[model samples]
Target chain A: QQPVQSPQAVILREGEDAVINCSSSKALYSVHWYRQKHGEAPVFLMILLKGGEQKGHDKISASFNEKKQQSSLYLTASQLSYSGTYFCPRRRNLEGSTLGRLYFGRGTQLTVWP
Target chain B: EPEVTQTPSHQVTQMGQEVILRCVPISNHLYFYWYRQILGQKVEFLVSFYNNEISEKSEIFDDQFSVERPDGSNFTLKIRSTKLEDSAMYFCASSRQGYTEAFFGQGTRLTVV
Candidate 1:
């Protein structure tokens, strides 16, 4: 199932902060965050694993709550380059070999103006 | 930096025709996947492939759709018969492992008329 993202859109000025949240109805083993500009493929941002393992961009931060099946991305002191849509793709904690696919949320559109 | 590359950045095909989108994932990656997004919609998974075989697929990957890793470096998604609804941006992604973050290609914008 697709995850749910809150605050469908957000507009912020440079140096401002913004928080994007994602929640899944089913058990998730990991949640991946990505950023996509207009007419572009999604770019990998970060990945939050179930047991606290994290990887990806050094500047961006995110947290995953296993018990709640939720994740949130934090963008502090945002820049004009941060203007894009954020998507959270999740992997289910299923015991099958076909666990290669990821289900992405609707995405949160963020616009940062200087 | 290693990155996935997709061909023909954009493709326009007629309804009921065949369309093939090609991708070359990062070297040494073991998992490959195909996803699509209609204009103004969420990205949807179509299929996943590993070890030269399909590992998982979504309902959207119907009989009209097929995937192939024809050579050592190329992966392809073929739509046997395209419909108007098949028009969308098709993205190819790959990961070092199934549990890792996948890198997406630039994507091929498929337009069916």
Candidate 2:
């Protein structure tokens, strides 16, 4: 099943901070994050494994909680270029499925102003 | 950096016509996938390919949809008798391994009338 993302949309100003959360009903092995601008392809951000490791780049960071089957993306000091929709594709345990199949969440739309 | 490349960028077709979207995944990658997103909706998985065969597919990938890796470098998704609902942005992605980061292509905007 597809994961669920919270705060369908968010608005932020330059230098502000925000958190986007994703939760899945099924147990997840890993979570992949991506950001998509208007009319563009989804850009890879980071991946969080089930070990509870936190991954980040620049001002964006993400953490995964295996027990809760949830992951969260933190955008620090947001910039105008950060304006986009964030998606979390949760990878479930591949007991009876393909390894590369990722179920994407509905996405969290973030709009950052100058 | 090596990235996935897609052709045409945009395509317009009539209902019941066949449409084929093409992609060139990064060299050395072992996994290829197809996804689509309708305007203002979430991205949906269509299928996954590996080792020149389909590894998994979603329900959205019905009988009307088929995928092929005609050559070592090219992968294609063919839709037979497309319907208006088939209009969406199709994205191709590839990854070095089954459980690694996958890079997405620019995507092909398909419009069916």
Candidate 3:
């Protein structure tokens, strides 16, 4: 099943902050975050495993709450380069299977202006 | 740094024609995948391949769709009969393992006219 992403679109000025949320109805074993620029492939940002882990890189961070079946991506002091679509893909815990094929959300279009 | 590479960045094919999108995954990666995204839409998984066989495939991967790892370094997705709705950006991705982070290629923009 596809995850639901909040704030279908967001516009922010340089150095501003934004938060994107993703919620899944199924129990997720892992959550992966990616950023895709126009006409480019989706770039891996971070991956959070189950057990309520929080991971960050540079000015971007994410938190996964397995019990709540939700994940939030936080971008701080955003840069112009951060203007792109953010996607949260989830892997469900299927019985007797570990193939880990990701189903992505609708994505949050983020525009960072100078 | 290793990366997945795709060929024919953009392709236009007539409806009902056959088209094959190619990819070369990073050396030593064990898993390969194909995904597609319509314009301004979310990416959707088509199929996953491992050990030269399909491990999983979504409903979108119907009878007309097939994947092949014909050679040691090349992976390909073939659409037997293209349809107008098949126009989309096709991406090839690979991961070191089944549950690891995946790296995607630039993608092939397939336009079925």
**Candidate 2 interface RMSD after superposing interface residues:** 2.7
Superposed on the true chain A, the predicted chain A of model 2 yields a TM-score of 0.91
lDDT of 2 by residue, B1-113 (tens): 89999987999999999999999999989899999999988889999999889989999999999999998899999999999999999999998888888899999999999
- For all predicted structures, in order, the TM-scores are 0.93, 0.94, 0.94
Q: Candidate 2, after superposition: displacement of residue A87 in Å? A: 1.1
Docking class of 3: medium
Computed on C-alphas against the true complex, the DockQ of each candidate is 0.63, 0.60, 0.59
Scored by CA lDDT, what does every candidate get? Answer: 0.89, 0.90, 0.91
lDDT tens digits, residue span B12-93, model 1: 9999999999999999999999999999898999999998899899999999999999999999999999999999999999
The best-first sequence of candidates by DockQ reads: 1, 2, 3
Q: Which wins on DockQ, candidate 2 or candidate 3?
A: 2
| Model 1 segments more than 4 A misplaced | A51-58, A93-98
> Candidates 1 and 2: which is better by TM-score?
2
User: Against the hidden true structure, what lDDT does model 1 obtain?
Assistant: 0.89
Clashes of each: 0, 0, 0
Model 2 spans with C-alpha error above 4 angstroms:
A93-97
